[model samples]
Target: MSRTIMLIPIGSGVGVTSVSLGMVRAMERHGVVVNFFKPIAQPKSGDTGPERSTTIIRNATNILPPEPFTMQYAENLISSNQTSDLLEEVVARFKTGTSEADVVVVEGLVPTIKHPFANELNYQIAKAIGAEMVFVTHPSNDSSQQLKERIEIAVSAFGGHKNTRIIGCIINKVGAPLDDQDRTRPDLTEMFEMPSSKTNTNLEVLQMFGKSPLRILGCIPWNPSLVAPRARDLAEHLDAIIINKGDMDTRRLQSVTFCARSIPNMVEHFKPGSMLVTSGDRSDVIVSACLASMNGVKIGCLLLTGNYRPEPQVMRLCERAMETTGLPIMMISTNTWQTSVRLQSFNMEIPTDDAERIELVQDYVAGHVDKHWIETLTQGSTLPRKLSPPAFRYHLTELARAVNRRIVLPEGDEPRTVKAASLCVQRGIATPILLGNPDKIQLVAEQQGVKLTEGVVIIDPVTVREKYVAPMVELRKGKGLTEVVAREQLQDNVVLGTMMLAQDEVDGLVSGAVHTTANTIRPPLQLIKTAPGANLVSSIFFMLLPDQVLVYGDCAINPDPNAEQLADIAIQSADSAAAFGIEPKVAMISYSTGSSGSGSDVEKVREATKIAQERRPDLIIDGPLQYDAAIMENVAKSKAPDSPVAGKATVFIFPDLNTGNTTYKAVQRSAELISIGPMLQGMRKPVNDLSRGALVDDIVYTIALTAIQASQQQ
Candidate 1:
């Protein structure tokens, strides 16, 4: 059974949507398969576009949450006294989307002026879904005592927190308490949570509960970046005419600078992500903006007030700079002062296209949630957690960031490898040392619009090959002592990278974006070799199916094996699944299920299953089962009713490479799923190979897997 947590706002503007998303992210970081559900679409305010949270989730995550019922449909149901039907509808949608999830975070409706029954509907939905309530609120001008009372009232309305149904509270958009002497109004930009240094208000708010049963799970500090509006959002809000729609949809306005001063004084305010609001008549300020754009300052936009357009002469002169810099420019009818006033009341809703801001908000808020409380949600749960694709990807990056291993990418100058290296460094997943010519790598990075950040180390192969020649010659001397052959082999980047791994110069190696599997793995097998285990090297692909991640073994290695070797492969695959947080239920796949069929393949599979079970009694190993009985519950009941691993197998040990590789590719393409590997197992050091047709993300995740394997190596 899956657990459900519903986030309901106790007051207005508590940022319930963001808090819900954050909860999902926090759980995913802990490797839980979490799902998100918004019961009903929120009524769009003005021209702010689609329901904010729903749109963001749809665009930003691999999670395909069911589209929420329209507000009109919900209102009509309630007016006709069909509240029960409404609750049933919500429950059906929630169950349909979250059946395989470990935890489902349901976003409750925020009570608005026109939607007074929001709280009641939220309560009913919570009861219907058996959801634990997490009341969301923010600190206001009211004293801590008053805030405590409000929380108490809200908790009492939700059955007074006596039972586990009332999980806790989340205080959002928390910042410093206001001073009595300070009469300045809070800045409009201070709306959503920011990375504020001052958190006195958060402390006070967290302590206000004062031994109340309701736990304070999170105290998200104010972060202005979460609410930063895109340039196009501002333009649409102000009904501004487009001057130059350069990067408007992507550029975010972090701060606004009104050109109240002359060119010399106002020039200091020009900076990246700052919107310059100046009248069009001010040629001095406009030209200054252009100059800043030319100087590589990514000015958010140039918003001209008073319905004015720049003179044709000024436009002609600055057109080249604006066009080259892709600087957004807009014209608003309101004067400077009026525009500032309108900006103060700007909508804080997130646009669907602002994926960066949405992810930022989720991660930022997730950081502040109590880790202990989050851990408790996962502990002692009997149900197996189905690791979703997003959860797996997030876990890989998070784990890679913690280990921070150095991985060598042999095909560094390859475009995908270059981009993946940059992304890995930027995301703190790994320090990628790219092995290629520096000039060629730079050219590739530039062509791909990838900034090979400082963390990405590039080494010229010519300079490094000679150093590894002696070592390679020494390692292969027993086979044939020849420095000439060693030097020739070291010319291959994969061989050079494998030598580095063998020498402990790098923690891991990721290659094969441009090379064949044999070209990639042959050097590793020759130099790095197999681990100290009693068996041969094998490979597994983390097939990220729609519902969960399954491990398919020996897909990229071992053409065929006897019963004993197949048993060893099954053990290795099961252990691998367990290492990656997947519960191991090894299934030995064959053309027939159980004792019903007699054939050489079935007998081999049955004997292999017996050998595996005898070797590792702890793992749930079953065999001679067809693919359908291995995974389908009904088929398992009809075919192999007494088998422990019949219906729910996380690891499939194929009899041969042909079967494993074909099945993985077929499922991956037919289901449109992502397979993270071909991740080599049983290697002494972490040296993973990629597909020749691998995308940038595929290479990045493979790098992460290699880093994790390196860190976890005994």
Candidate 2:
């Protein structure tokens, strides 16, 4: 079960999105897999895209959050007195997106004239999802006592703080302490619309909440950079025409300057990232800007007024400077004063493509948030650590990054393989060596919009096949001593890659995106062989059920094992589960529960359980249990009351491949869950096989698993 944290705004424009994003990053820094969710979309005025919070999260991180329901949908439900249905929908979407996360951060809807029931909806949704609340508010002209009363009222509406659902509060956009001059003039405010002078200071706010049950998470100070818009945004807002569109998308305007003075005086305001607004006839100002650009000053852009374009001669004279500096230049019909007025009321919504600013805001807000509180939330957690699918995948990526091994991909020319290889290299999961024709692989990457960076190594099989032929001949000389057969076998990329792994040239191998499973696993069995265990190779798939991740063993290998081989498979599966961070609660599956029924299969399972228990008593191993009794608590209590591993089994060992494979496919397809592998265990070297219908993400995670396996062998 995922823990939920809801951020509710005390008033409009409280920066709830930023607060939610900050909390997520802070939790991630502590190594928790966090998911961001917004139940309803609240599009601001003139905004036609997706909700800002979801967009920012998707662009900034690897997590792909679910799209929010539109406001119209919620409105219709509320109008028809179907609010219960609305909350049911919210809960369904929430569970769908967050079932695989350790923690989920939900951003509540902001109260506006268009939606008066937002606050009530927020409360109802939080209750429906069982989310703890974190009230987000800014100190805007409210005294200490006034702020305390406001929060008290909100808490009472939320069933009071006695329930402890209201965990804490964040004071965002805290203004700087007022100086004597500012204190004397109560109406004075900063240029960037900082908190008013009447608002209480940080100390006053904290002291006010000292006696309250809610914790004061942090007081985030006002940051003007977070509210600044890019030059491209300004251009779109003013409907300006481009004169020299350079760095418009990336250059952010930190401040606006009106060049009303002469060249000597106006040049003093030429700061980097400052937008200069002046009449188009000011050739002197244009010449000064060109000179500043030549001297390494990167002003955001030059905004011309009154539909003016610079004289052709002046632009021609500064052509070299413009070309060298790539200064962003644009013109608008509005005069200087009009433009300034529009700038004062500009929209400050963060765009989806402004990745640099999004990262800046995430880091900035996370830095100001309470680190000790975050540590307590993550380190001192008392919730059950049920491994979800997202959490498992996140764990794989982090583990693979720590190891940083090289993995060989045999089907590099395949489109999905090429994209997955590029992603792995870019994300530092592994250094994947793609074995194919370099030109063909490059063409595939270009077609897929994947940038093959320097980290993605492309090795042509034709050049490397000859080198491996002699080594393969020596390794398999006992089978038949012939160079011709070795060369012929080396033509297959899977065989070549397996030989590489056998020779210790690469850390691991992942293939079968385009090849058959036999083609992938045969070479490894022929060359690398099994580990120094007294048994055959077996396979397991990490079945990602809705609530937790379960392990199903012998699903892809080993048909009809006897008592001894079944016991060995159980032991190997348990070891693999433990290695990958899953608690090893072994359940030997059969058609019976305990001694209820007798058959050859049930007897085999019973004997296998006893042998496994004798071999490793530390593991929780029980046998001859039905699938429902092994997994469901009620069934376990009724059918196998005294069995230790009757319920809550994380690893299931089948008596034969026929049962295992059919059961795994049934559950996987019926539930539409993600199944990670058929990861081969008991291999001397780390060699894994993939499915022919694998997606890019499936391939990437398999590579990560292979890397972790290689590291474990070391």
Candidate 3:
């Protein structure tokens, strides 16, 4: 079942729409796929009227609609006592809105709007929709008694409603608490819910209300930024034409300044976040506004009224001054007085156009809202936490940034490599050391329309040859290498980049966008060598499928292995999966599950499973299992009922290269999967190989995985 919240206002001007939208954004930020619904909206007169809160919300959030209702329709139903029909309509619309999302936030009616008893009407709506109420009250200095009376009225109104529940209340726009009223909670709860037996006039209300059900969740302080109107918004509201639209979306107009006075005196009113309004023919004040903008004075905007255009020569001068600054200029057809009225009436809502205020609310809601309350709302949620392909790819960048290791790319002159390096640097995931001539790398970057920022470390392998010659000679002495031979070996960019990693100059090296996997891994095998206890250097492809990230091991290495080596590959693949945030549930896949079929292949997998299980006792591993039984829960139940890892395998260890290679390709070709690596494991230092046909994003993710591996080894 989805979590449904009904935001009911105690009175007007309580910022209900903002609070509701903020809740949606907050839930969305925490990975909840949330939807929105406004059951009742106040009547609107014409097409040119301001957008309803629901219309604004749907547009701003990029969530499409089932549009909200106008109160006139709901008013007719309620006036004729057709509450059942009204409630059913709301319920039907809400179901449509929630069909695909995790939580649906239903914005209900505000008090003192149409349907004078809308709070009571809201209770019926809530009961029909099965919503929990979160009552919102605007509190102030004298709000102690006012809040007390309102709470009693609401509790009494909704008390006998069987289907609805009061989840909580929020003390909104609180300047502070009253100094004289008893501020203790137990005493306040008593006043809010009185005894029924006595009479509930004081006791008349108590007759219905057993006890106040309000749990005060939070108190959000009054913030002017949250309610400030954008200069662009006001311009659009008045049908005012914009002369210069620069930075209008971000420039907030907190207060208005009518500059009908002289320049010297009007300049005194030119405070930050104040919009100056004057007749368009007033060139003196217009020039003053432009000069203020040029001098870094943040006057929100300049509004020219009375439909009078500036002289051609004066307009040219004003445009010239504005060109040096990004201040907004607008022209209004109305006189100063009427324009001022429009400004006062302009909606200070979280409109689709104002990204600045939306961002502010995202931050505010994150900080002030009760986190426990938010979590409680989602505690019974059915939203899947599956690592989807896009989500998985996005998360890889985050994990890579955690370590920020240096990763060298050997194919720097290749366009894909250069573009990928720029992306890695731009995302702060890794410091990519691109090995190529600086000139050629820049030429390739320019061709790709990507700039290789200073963050990309460009080094000519030829220039770095002298530094690596001695070190390479020492590392390869066991193979009868001389300084002359080492120089020739280091001439290859992949070799040079690998030598950098082996010498501790860089944390990892990723190559092979243009080279073969053998060519990429050869230098590392010869120089960096395998880890101490590891028997072989194996490679695993991080197959990013539609719903999850899976590991296909030994697909790029070890053509065929006996039981012991197969066990090691399985163990290593499991470790790799866990290192990258996937808990290893190893499936030693074969043509048969258990002893259902017998052959050399089946026996080899069964033995390998036993050996792998012995190696990592804590791991959930099972083997001699077919792919269907391993990955599908229903198949596993029928084929290998008791195996822990059977249905949930994230790491698949292939029995040999022929099976592994072909299966991964089939999966990729058929499903259009994004395979990130042939990420080599068990190296003393980190060195991963990429596919020759890898996209820019593919290379970026490989570099990230290499960096993460380097971090783990460190």
lDDT (C-alpha) at residue 510 in model 2:
98
Clash-forming residue pairs, model 3: 199-203, 199-204, 200-203, 200-204, 200-205, 201-204
Residues 350-376 of candidate 1: C-alpha lDDT, one tens digit per residue: 667777788778778877888778878
TM-score of each: 0.68, 0.59, 0.57
Report the lDDT tens digits of candidate 3 across residue range 170-207.
66665422223322111111123323322112212222
Which consecutive 10 residues in model 3 have the weakest lDDT in total? Answer: 182-191
Stretches > 4 Å off in candidate 1: 1-4, 10-14, 25-40, 46-104, 116-133, 137-168, 171-216, 219-368, 378-384, 387-404, 412-431, 436-465, 560-565, 594-619, 692-697
The alpha-carbon deviation from the true structure for residue 655 of candidate 3, after best TM-score superposition, in angstroms, is 1.2
TM-score of 3: 0.57
* lDDT over C-alpha atoms for residue 356 of model 3: 57
Q: Any runs in candidate 3 off by more than 4 Å, and if so which? A: 1-384
Whole-model Cα lDDT per candidate? 0.83, 0.83, 0.76
Candidate 1 whole-model C-alpha lDDT, 0 to 1: 0.83
Clash pairs of candidate 1? 193-222, 193-223, 194-222, 194-223
